[model samples]
Target: MIDAINRKIIAALQQNARISYAELGKKVHLSAPAVAERIRKLESAGIITGYSVKVDLDKLGYPILAMVQCKVYRAKEREFKALLLSYDEVIECINVTGEQAFLVKLAVESLSQLDAILEAFIDLSDTNTMMILSTPVDRALPETFIK
Candidate 1:
């Protein structure tokens, strides 16, 4: 049950969630209090989650970004999962099919740092590494068509 008003409010928020209630009210043709009420409802309904800023890892001194495909050897699944969770550099880890058991995307400061990180995986059978050159397209969810 997506109401037209809610859709418009969502679109506006998606554009800039930090917009003032008065400004949002003007755009949505409602009072500031009305806008606040609508936003509260949206938040309470779990439609609007917490906001986050997208960070540039390279500029922050983490210049190395690589997708390391790993094949866990002679391992129990519990230990493997714990090991993955213990590392801070590992932004994303997944168990997959094909030649590798897991693929890990890492953000590291340097090759030495990456090597240090990979040292933890000494027990792993083999790992295929591919360094990311450039991000051609980092797409966000489509909100323009919601209205």
Candidate 2:
């Protein structure tokens, strides 16, 4: 179970995953080894999943970002998922309840590229897509949960 110290560690790591254990320990008022042990425990308990890097899609030549909501028939769900897994342009995909079966985020260099990616899904799902203008709030997670 996570305590207040763990919450602080999680918050610091979320902001910068590359923070050294010694530095992190200083922030949490623990020794470097203690901090390392706590982090190891968190990892073992699956509380700490993995670290990732944030990249600029525009700088990478993928300026267009689109959120595509797919209404895939139950019978074609597996095929649709398989096709989605094959596309490197797909940034994220989530299955949800309601009118839409899956929400897919795609990053591409041009409108034509986005169109081609969308076309592949046409046979499997009815899709509604919106180009992302600007993300005012990106990925933000609560450091501590209220019980």
Candidate 3:
């Protein structure tokens, strides 16, 4: 149901969520009130889900970022997911297709901590982990689709 103006608003908000309504209005050629109304409608329609802040995990003492692909036993999927939910270190867990059932992203202070976390999952799943060296393209969404 999004029109060209709404698409522009979404694109602008994606770049900077903290943008003032008045400033955003200027960008989309609308009044502040109109901009606010459109944003509210977007939220009500469940398009604009939530806003978040990006943080430096390394500075926060979680220097190690690892991607753990887990091939969970069919009977143990629920148990494996329950364990994943308990850990604060688990930043993202995606249920995906392939040899792996779950792709988990973990941030930890050290290799020892990472090992301990992996040990907990070994009973229910076989894991293949890769430490992230650098993220050249992090969370890049297509602007072409928006336009």
Lowest lDDT 10-residue stretch of candidate 2: 138-147
Q: How do these models rank on lDDT, best leading?
A: 3, 2, 1
Q: List the pairs of residues colliding in candidate 1.
A: none
On residues 17-55, what C-alpha lDDT tens digit does candidate 2 reach at each position? 999999999999999999999999999998899999999
What is the Å distance of residue 107 in model 1 from its true position? Answer: 1.2
The weakest ten consecutive residues by lDDT in model 1 span 138-147
> Across residues 1-147, which tens digit of lDDT does each residue of candidate 1 receive?
246777777877776778898998888799999888988887887877766667899999899999998877765556766877888899998889976888999999899988887887766547788998989987545655553
* Superior by TM-score: candidate 1 or candidate 2: 2
RMSD in angstroms, candidate 2? 1.2
- Per-prediction CA RMSD (Å): 3.1, 1.2, 1.2
User: What lDDT does candidate 3 reach at residue 99?
Assistant: 74
lDDT of 1 at 135: 90
Off-target runs (Cα >4 Å) in candidate 1 are: 73-75, 94-101, 124-126, 144-147
**Global lDDT of each candidate:** 0.80, 0.92, 0.92
Rank candidates by TM-score, best first.
Answer: 2, 3, 1
